[model samples]
Target: MKLLEVKLLTDNLSLAEKFYGKQLGFTRCHLSADELQIEMGSSVLIFRQTKEIKKPVYHFALNIPNNRLNEAIDWISAIASPLKLNSQGEIIADFRNWNAKSIYFIDPIGNIVEFIARFNLPNQSTEPFSVKSILTISEIGLVVNVVKNTVLEFADRFALDIFVPSTSTEQFAALGNDEGLFIVSEKNRHWYPTMINAQPFPLEIKFETDNNVVYNLSI
Candidate 1:
Protein backbone atom coordinates (compact mmCIF):
# COMPACT_ATOMS: atom_id res chain seq x y z
CA MET A 1 0.00 0.00 0.00
CA LYS A 2 1.18 3.52 -0.72
CA LEU A 3 0.99 6.04 2.08
CA LEU A 4 -0.98 9.05 0.96
CA GLU A 5 -0.87 11.21 4.08
CA VAL A 6 -0.31 11.32 7.82
CA LYS A 7 -2.31 13.53 10.19
CA LEU A 8 -0.78 14.45 13.50
CA LEU A 9 -2.02 16.40 16.52
CA THR A 10 0.01 19.22 17.91
CA ASP A 11 -0.58 21.69 20.69
CA ASN A 12 1.63 24.29 19.08
CA LEU A 13 0.62 25.14 15.56
CA SER A 14 3.09 27.98 15.06
CA LEU A 15 5.98 25.83 16.18
CA ALA A 16 4.80 23.02 13.91
CA GLU A 17 4.57 25.43 11.01
CA LYS A 18 8.07 26.80 11.54
CA PHE A 19 9.65 23.40 12.01
CA TYR A 20 7.95 21.69 9.06
CA GLY A 21 7.98 24.68 6.77
CA LYS A 22 11.17 26.52 7.67
CA GLN A 23 13.37 23.75 9.01
CA LEU A 24 12.30 20.68 7.05
CA GLY A 25 11.61 22.72 3.88
CA PHE A 26 8.08 21.36 3.46
CA THR A 27 5.81 23.83 1.73
CA ARG A 28 2.63 24.95 3.44
CA CYS A 29 -0.32 23.86 1.37
CA HIS A 30 -3.05 25.01 3.76
CA LEU A 31 -3.33 26.45 7.20
CA SER A 32 -5.73 27.57 9.92
CA ALA A 33 -5.34 28.49 13.58
CA ASP A 34 -5.97 24.96 14.74
CA GLU A 35 -4.86 23.05 11.67
CA LEU A 36 -1.93 23.20 9.26
CA GLN A 37 -1.16 21.21 6.15
CA ILE A 38 2.22 20.64 4.52
CA GLU A 39 2.81 19.05 1.16
CA MET A 40 5.57 16.53 0.60
CA GLY A 41 5.45 15.66 -3.08
CA SER A 42 2.26 13.63 -3.68
CA SER A 43 1.61 13.06 0.00
CA VAL A 44 0.27 15.60 2.49
CA LEU A 45 1.09 15.72 6.20
CA ILE A 46 -1.57 17.36 8.35
CA PHE A 47 -1.09 18.82 11.81
CA ARG A 48 -4.00 19.64 14.11
CA GLN A 49 -4.37 20.84 17.65
CA THR A 50 -5.39 18.51 20.47
CA LYS A 51 -5.72 19.00 24.19
CA GLU A 52 -5.19 15.44 25.30
CA ILE A 53 -3.16 13.25 22.97
CA LYS A 54 -0.47 10.62 22.96
CA LYS A 55 2.92 11.64 21.54
CA PRO A 56 4.26 8.46 20.08
CA VAL A 57 7.89 8.18 19.13
CA TYR A 58 7.98 7.21 15.47
CA HIS A 59 10.46 7.25 12.60
CA PHE A 60 9.45 7.66 8.94
CA ALA A 61 11.72 7.45 5.90
CA LEU A 62 12.11 9.18 2.55
CA ASN A 63 13.66 7.66 -0.59
CA ILE A 64 16.08 9.56 -2.80
CA PRO A 65 18.22 8.69 -5.78
CA ASN A 66 21.30 6.65 -4.96
CA ASN A 67 23.49 9.16 -6.77
CA ARG A 68 21.99 11.92 -4.64
CA LEU A 69 22.97 10.23 -1.40
CA ASN A 70 25.75 12.68 -0.68
CA GLU A 71 23.67 15.62 -1.82
CA ALA A 72 20.71 14.59 0.29
CA ILE A 73 22.91 14.01 3.31
CA ASP A 74 24.59 17.37 2.90
CA TRP A 75 21.29 19.15 2.41
CA ILE A 76 19.69 17.61 5.49
CA SER A 77 22.77 18.14 7.62
CA ALA A 78 22.76 21.78 6.74
CA ILE A 79 19.20 22.08 8.01
CA ALA A 80 19.27 19.71 11.00
CA SER A 81 21.85 18.09 13.21
CA PRO A 82 22.30 14.35 12.98
CA LEU A 83 20.92 12.12 15.68
CA LYS A 84 23.51 9.45 14.90
CA LEU A 85 26.16 9.62 12.25
CA ASN A 86 29.61 8.43 11.26
CA SER A 87 32.66 10.65 11.17
CA GLN A 88 31.70 11.64 7.62
CA GLY A 89 28.36 13.01 8.95
CA GLU A 90 26.32 10.36 7.18
CA ILE A 91 24.27 7.74 8.98
CA ILE A 92 26.29 4.63 9.73
CA ALA A 93 25.88 2.05 6.95
CA ASP A 94 25.12 -1.50 7.97
CA PHE A 95 26.62 -3.65 5.24
CA ARG A 96 24.77 -6.76 6.40
CA ASN A 97 21.43 -5.01 6.33
CA TRP A 98 19.82 -2.62 3.85
CA ASN A 99 23.17 -0.89 3.27
CA ALA A 100 21.42 2.32 2.33
CA LYS A 101 23.04 5.73 2.81
CA SER A 102 20.87 7.37 5.42
CA ILE A 103 20.68 10.04 8.10
CA TYR A 104 18.31 10.42 11.04
CA PHE A 105 17.22 13.62 12.77
CA ILE A 106 14.81 14.70 15.47
CA ASP A 107 12.30 17.28 14.42
CA PRO A 108 11.33 20.17 16.67
CA ILE A 109 8.52 17.97 17.95
CA GLY A 110 10.95 15.14 18.57
CA ASN A 111 9.82 12.83 15.79
CA ILE A 112 12.63 10.79 14.30
CA VAL A 113 12.80 11.55 10.58
CA GLU A 114 15.04 9.77 8.11
CA PHE A 115 16.46 10.54 4.69
CA ILE A 116 17.65 7.47 2.82
CA ALA A 117 19.02 6.44 -0.54
CA ARG A 118 18.55 2.72 -0.99
CA PHE A 119 21.55 1.03 -2.60
CA ASN A 120 19.78 -1.98 -4.09
CA LEU A 121 17.36 0.08 -6.14
CA PRO A 122 18.42 0.92 -9.67
CA ASN A 123 20.02 4.32 -9.92
CA GLN A 124 17.73 6.84 -11.51
CA SER A 125 18.85 9.84 -13.55
CA THR A 126 20.79 12.42 -11.58
CA GLU A 127 18.55 15.42 -12.02
CA PRO A 128 18.41 18.71 -10.17
CA PHE A 129 16.59 18.45 -6.84
CA SER A 130 12.92 19.23 -6.76
CA VAL A 131 10.19 18.62 -4.20
CA LYS A 132 8.59 16.23 -6.67
CA SER A 133 11.86 14.36 -6.99
CA ILE A 134 13.33 14.08 -3.50
CA LEU A 135 10.76 15.11 -0.91
CA THR A 136 8.19 12.42 -1.62
CA ILE A 137 6.90 10.56 1.39
CA SER A 138 8.18 7.00 1.55
CA GLU A 139 7.16 5.37 4.84
CA ILE A 140 5.14 6.00 7.99
CA GLY A 141 6.33 4.49 11.24
CA LEU A 142 3.92 3.30 13.91
CA VAL A 143 5.19 2.91 17.45
CA VAL A 144 3.31 0.13 19.22
CA ASN A 145 3.52 -1.36 22.68
CA VAL A 146 4.38 -4.84 21.43
CA VAL A 147 4.14 -7.26 18.53
CA LYS A 148 0.76 -8.40 19.68
CA ASN A 149 -1.60 -10.53 17.60
CA THR A 150 -3.90 -7.53 17.43
CA VAL A 151 -1.21 -5.59 15.57
CA LEU A 152 -0.99 -8.36 12.99
CA GLU A 153 -4.75 -8.34 12.73
CA PHE A 154 -4.62 -4.63 11.97
CA ALA A 155 -1.98 -5.27 9.33
CA ASP A 156 -4.12 -7.93 7.69
CA ARG A 157 -7.03 -5.57 7.64
CA PHE A 158 -4.89 -3.04 5.86
CA ALA A 159 -3.48 -5.73 3.49
CA LEU A 160 0.06 -5.20 4.76
CA ASP A 161 2.62 -7.98 4.51
CA ILE A 162 4.79 -8.86 7.44
CA PHE A 163 8.09 -8.03 5.81
CA VAL A 164 10.27 -8.66 8.85
CA PRO A 165 9.41 -9.48 12.40
CA SER A 166 11.66 -8.23 15.16
CA THR A 167 13.83 -11.23 16.11
CA SER A 168 16.93 -9.72 17.63
CA THR A 169 14.83 -7.08 19.31
CA GLU A 170 11.38 -7.86 20.67
CA GLN A 171 10.79 -4.14 20.68
CA PHE A 172 10.05 -3.62 17.00
CA ALA A 173 8.14 -4.98 14.00
CA ALA A 174 8.46 -3.89 10.38
CA LEU A 175 5.38 -4.45 8.19
CA GLY A 176 4.87 -3.44 4.58
CA ASN A 177 4.08 -4.46 1.02
CA ASP A 178 4.86 -2.90 -2.40
CA GLU A 179 3.42 0.43 -1.27
CA GLY A 180 5.55 1.36 1.75
CA LEU A 181 6.69 0.26 5.19
CA PHE A 182 5.15 0.72 8.64
CA ILE A 183 7.40 0.11 11.62
CA VAL A 184 5.71 -0.81 14.91
CA SER A 185 7.72 -0.81 18.07
CA GLU A 186 7.29 -1.36 21.77
CA LYS A 187 6.60 2.02 23.42
CA ASN A 188 9.11 3.69 25.77
CA ARG A 189 11.97 1.62 24.36
CA HIS A 190 12.28 3.98 21.41
CA TRP A 191 13.91 7.39 21.58
CA TYR A 192 10.60 9.27 21.49
CA PRO A 193 7.57 8.38 23.59
CA THR A 194 3.99 9.72 23.47
CA MET A 195 4.11 11.24 26.90
CA ILE A 196 7.33 13.10 26.32
CA ASN A 197 6.68 14.98 23.10
CA ALA A 198 3.10 16.18 23.05
CA GLN A 199 3.16 17.58 19.54
CA PRO A 200 2.72 15.58 16.32
CA PHE A 201 0.38 12.88 17.54
CA PRO A 202 -0.26 10.16 15.00
CA LEU A 203 -3.76 10.72 13.72
CA GLU A 204 -3.83 8.85 10.44
CA ILE A 205 -1.33 7.04 8.23
CA LYS A 206 -2.27 6.02 4.69
CA PHE A 207 -0.39 3.73 2.33
CA GLU A 208 -0.99 3.37 -1.39
CA THR A 209 -1.40 -0.17 -2.68
CA ASP A 210 -0.74 -1.72 -6.07
CA ASN A 211 -4.43 -2.34 -6.70
CA ASN A 212 -5.28 1.34 -6.10
CA VAL A 213 -6.48 0.62 -2.60
CA VAL A 214 -4.96 3.16 -0.26
CA TYR A 215 -4.59 1.50 3.12
CA ASN A 216 -5.44 3.98 5.86
CA LEU A 217 -5.03 3.76 9.63
CA SER A 218 -6.35 6.40 12.03
CA ILE A 219 -5.16 6.85 15.59
Candidate 2:
Protein backbone atom coordinates (compact mmCIF):
# COMPACT_ATOMS: atom_id res chain seq x y z
CA MET A 1 0.00 0.00 0.00
CA LYS A 2 1.03 3.63 -0.52
CA LEU A 3 -0.06 6.60 1.54
CA LEU A 4 -0.91 9.36 -0.90
CA GLU A 5 -2.16 12.10 1.39
CA VAL A 6 -3.10 12.85 4.99
CA LYS A 7 -5.08 15.68 6.50
CA LEU A 8 -4.52 16.43 10.18
CA LEU A 9 -5.74 19.06 12.61
CA THR A 10 -3.61 21.80 14.10
CA ASP A 11 -4.43 24.65 16.40
CA ASN A 12 -1.89 27.03 14.99
CA LEU A 13 -1.50 27.07 11.26
CA SER A 14 1.07 29.86 11.13
CA LEU A 15 3.42 28.10 13.52
CA ALA A 16 3.04 24.86 11.61
CA GLU A 17 3.80 26.66 8.37
CA LYS A 18 6.91 28.21 9.84
CA PHE A 19 8.18 24.96 11.33
CA TYR A 20 7.53 22.78 8.29
CA GLY A 21 8.14 25.29 5.53
CA LYS A 22 10.76 27.64 6.91
CA GLN A 23 12.49 25.65 9.63
CA LEU A 24 12.56 22.23 8.02
CA GLY A 25 12.58 23.79 4.54
CA PHE A 26 10.08 21.41 3.00
CA THR A 27 8.09 22.51 -0.01
CA ARG A 28 4.85 23.95 1.37
CA CYS A 29 1.99 26.17 0.27
CA HIS A 30 -0.93 27.87 1.90
CA LEU A 31 -4.07 26.07 0.90
CA SER A 32 -6.29 28.68 2.48
CA ALA A 33 -6.40 31.02 5.47
CA ASP A 34 -6.52 27.98 7.72
CA GLU A 35 -4.88 25.23 5.74
CA LEU A 36 -1.25 24.40 4.90
CA GLN A 37 -0.04 21.76 2.51
CA ILE A 38 3.45 20.22 2.54
CA GLU A 39 4.97 17.99 -0.08
CA MET A 40 6.93 15.01 1.17
CA GLY A 41 8.26 13.39 -1.96
CA SER A 42 5.49 11.06 -3.13
CA SER A 43 3.11 11.92 -0.31
CA VAL A 44 1.34 15.09 0.67
CA LEU A 45 0.62 16.23 4.25
CA ILE A 46 -2.09 18.76 4.91
CA PHE A 47 -2.68 20.53 8.20
CA ARG A 48 -6.13 21.96 8.70
CA GLN A 49 -6.54 24.69 11.24
CA THR A 50 -8.93 23.97 14.08
CA LYS A 51 -10.47 26.02 16.88
CA GLU A 52 -11.22 23.17 19.25
CA ILE A 53 -10.12 23.96 22.78
CA LYS A 54 -8.13 20.80 23.00
CA LYS A 55 -5.08 20.78 20.75
CA PRO A 56 -4.62 17.74 18.56
CA VAL A 57 -1.34 15.92 18.48
CA TYR A 58 -0.55 13.10 16.08
CA HIS A 59 2.19 10.59 15.38
CA PHE A 60 3.26 9.97 11.81
CA ALA A 61 6.27 8.50 10.03
CA LEU A 62 8.01 9.20 6.76
CA ASN A 63 9.98 6.70 4.74
CA ILE A 64 13.58 7.55 4.00
CA PRO A 65 16.19 5.87 1.84
CA ASN A 66 17.38 2.65 3.41
CA ASN A 67 21.02 3.70 3.16
CA ARG A 68 20.50 7.29 4.29
CA LEU A 69 19.51 6.78 7.92
CA ASN A 70 22.61 8.42 9.31
CA GLU A 71 22.52 11.18 6.74
CA ALA A 72 18.86 11.81 7.58
CA ILE A 73 19.68 12.08 11.25
CA ASP A 74 22.38 14.60 10.51
CA TRP A 75 20.14 16.61 8.24
CA ILE A 76 17.15 16.83 10.63
CA SER A 77 19.30 17.29 13.71
CA ALA A 78 20.48 20.54 12.22
CA ILE A 79 16.93 21.84 12.52
CA ALA A 80 15.48 20.09 15.58
CA SER A 81 16.86 17.97 18.39
CA PRO A 82 16.24 14.28 17.81
CA LEU A 83 14.31 12.61 20.62
CA LYS A 84 16.21 9.94 22.51
CA LEU A 85 14.76 6.47 22.45
CA ASN A 86 16.87 4.81 25.10
CA SER A 87 18.44 5.41 28.47
CA GLN A 88 21.82 5.52 26.75
CA GLY A 89 20.80 8.80 25.10
CA GLU A 90 20.51 7.01 21.80
CA ILE A 91 18.26 8.68 19.25
CA ILE A 92 17.93 5.84 16.75
CA ALA A 93 15.50 2.99 17.40
CA ASP A 94 16.68 -0.18 15.73
CA PHE A 95 13.79 -2.51 14.99
CA ARG A 96 15.85 -5.58 14.12
CA ASN A 97 12.78 -7.72 13.60
CA TRP A 98 11.41 -5.26 11.06
CA ASN A 99 14.82 -4.56 9.55
CA ALA A 100 14.32 -0.87 10.08
CA LYS A 101 15.86 2.07 11.92
CA SER A 102 13.95 5.18 13.00
CA ILE A 103 14.59 8.56 14.51
CA TYR A 104 11.97 10.69 16.20
CA PHE A 105 11.37 14.38 16.70
CA ILE A 106 8.52 16.68 17.66
CA ASP A 107 7.05 19.37 15.48
CA PRO A 108 6.22 22.77 16.88
CA ILE A 109 2.70 21.62 17.83
CA GLY A 110 4.07 18.66 19.79
CA ASN A 111 3.23 16.13 17.09
CA ILE A 112 5.54 13.15 17.18
CA VAL A 113 7.22 12.84 13.81
CA GLU A 114 9.39 9.95 12.69
CA PHE A 115 11.76 9.27 9.83
CA ILE A 116 12.19 5.57 9.24
CA ALA A 117 14.48 3.60 6.95
CA ARG A 118 13.36 0.08 6.17
CA PHE A 119 16.32 -1.90 4.92
CA ASN A 120 14.06 -4.44 3.25
CA LEU A 121 12.79 -1.75 0.94
CA PRO A 122 14.48 -0.77 -2.32
CA ASN A 123 14.74 2.88 -1.38
CA GLN A 124 18.47 3.45 -1.49
CA SER A 125 19.73 6.79 -2.70
CA THR A 126 23.14 8.05 -3.77
CA GLU A 127 22.30 11.66 -3.08
CA PRO A 128 22.81 13.26 0.31
CA PHE A 129 19.85 13.01 2.67
CA SER A 130 17.60 16.05 2.82
CA VAL A 131 13.93 16.88 2.63
CA LYS A 132 13.99 15.55 -0.92
CA SER A 133 15.15 12.18 0.36
CA ILE A 134 11.83 11.51 2.03
CA LEU A 135 10.24 8.68 0.09
CA THR A 136 6.67 9.02 1.40
CA ILE A 137 4.39 9.23 4.39
CA SER A 138 4.54 5.62 5.47
CA GLU A 139 2.65 5.43 8.75
CA ILE A 140 -0.09 7.18 10.63
CA GLY A 141 -1.03 6.45 14.23
CA LEU A 142 -4.75 6.16 14.84
CA VAL A 143 -5.71 6.24 18.49
CA VAL A 144 -8.89 4.44 19.41
CA ASN A 145 -10.74 3.25 22.47
CA VAL A 146 -10.28 -0.39 21.52
CA VAL A 147 -7.35 -1.62 19.50
CA LYS A 148 -8.77 -5.00 18.48
CA ASN A 149 -12.06 -3.61 17.23
CA THR A 150 -10.46 -0.75 15.38
CA VAL A 151 -7.89 -3.02 13.79
CA LEU A 152 -10.56 -5.45 12.67
CA GLU A 153 -12.80 -2.70 11.36
CA PHE A 154 -9.98 -1.10 9.41
CA ALA A 155 -8.89 -4.45 7.98
CA ASP A 156 -12.40 -5.13 6.75
CA ARG A 157 -12.90 -1.61 5.47
CA PHE A 158 -9.63 -1.29 3.61
CA ALA A 159 -8.99 -4.94 2.80
CA LEU A 160 -5.65 -4.67 4.56
CA ASP A 161 -3.45 -7.37 5.93
CA ILE A 162 -1.58 -7.33 9.17
CA PHE A 163 2.01 -6.22 8.85
CA VAL A 164 4.50 -9.00 9.36
CA PRO A 165 6.44 -9.11 12.65
CA SER A 166 3.82 -6.88 14.28
CA THR A 167 1.62 -8.92 16.57
CA SER A 168 -1.72 -7.48 17.52
CA THR A 169 -2.41 -6.93 21.19
CA GLU A 170 -4.86 -5.10 23.40
CA GLN A 171 -2.62 -2.07 23.32
CA PHE A 172 -1.36 -1.96 19.76
CA ALA A 173 -1.75 -3.27 16.23
CA ALA A 174 -0.40 -2.44 12.80
CA LEU A 175 -2.17 -2.98 9.47
CA GLY A 176 -0.98 -2.89 5.87
CA ASN A 177 2.61 -3.39 4.69
CA ASP A 178 6.02 -1.79 4.87
CA GLU A 179 5.10 0.83 2.29
CA GLY A 180 2.13 2.10 4.25
CA LEU A 181 0.58 1.26 7.62
CA PHE A 182 -2.11 2.33 10.00
CA ILE A 183 -0.99 2.00 13.61
CA VAL A 184 -4.00 1.40 15.83
CA SER A 185 -3.55 1.63 19.55
CA GLU A 186 -5.80 2.03 22.56
CA LYS A 187 -6.15 5.52 23.92
CA ASN A 188 -3.59 6.65 26.51
CA ARG A 189 -0.98 4.16 25.37
CA HIS A 190 2.31 5.92 25.25
CA TRP A 191 3.82 6.02 21.80
CA TYR A 192 6.94 3.91 21.51
CA PRO A 193 10.01 5.55 23.09
CA THR A 194 7.98 8.51 24.25
CA MET A 195 5.78 9.47 27.20
CA ILE A 196 3.01 11.14 25.26
CA ASN A 197 -0.36 9.45 25.63
CA ALA A 198 -2.36 8.73 22.50
CA GLN A 199 -5.54 10.70 21.90
CA PRO A 200 -8.33 10.56 19.35
CA PHE A 201 -8.68 13.43 16.91
CA PRO A 202 -10.19 14.16 13.53
CA LEU A 203 -8.08 13.35 10.48
CA GLU A 204 -8.31 12.10 6.91
CA ILE A 205 -6.13 9.72 4.93
CA LYS A 206 -5.98 8.66 1.28
CA PHE A 207 -4.10 5.54 0.26
CA GLU A 208 -3.73 3.04 -2.54
CA THR A 209 -2.95 -0.64 -2.44
CA ASP A 210 -0.80 -2.86 -4.66
CA ASN A 211 -3.87 -3.85 -6.68
CA ASN A 212 -4.59 -0.19 -7.52
CA VAL A 213 -7.48 0.21 -5.09
CA VAL A 214 -7.84 3.65 -3.52
CA TYR A 215 -9.48 4.57 -0.22
CA ASN A 216 -10.30 7.89 1.29
CA LEU A 217 -11.05 7.54 4.99
CA SER A 218 -11.81 9.94 7.77
CA ILE A 219 -11.42 9.44 11.52
Q: For each of the candidates, give the backbone clash count.
A: 9, 0
Determine the C-alpha RMSD for candidate 1 after optimal superposition of all C-alphas.
3.8
Q: Write the per-residue lDDT of candidate 2 for residues 1-219, one digit (tens) a residue.
A: 999999999989899999988888886555679899998989999999999735799999999999999998989989889999777899999989888999999988989999999988998999998788988999999999988888778778777877888788899988988999998879999987789999998999999987899989899
**Best by TM-score, which number?**
2
Report the lDDT of model 2 for residue 129.
84
Q: Look at candidate 1 and tell me the lDDT of residue 197.
A: 29
Candidate 1 residue-wise lDDT, 112-208, digit = tens: 7776666666745468554445545666766555656636676577655565422325665566642356666665554432233222246687667
lDDT for predicted candidate 2 compared with the true structure: 0.90
Which consecutive 10 residues in model 2 have the weakest lDDT in total? 23-32
The TM-score of candidate 2 is 0.97
Identify the leading candidate in terms of lDDT: 2
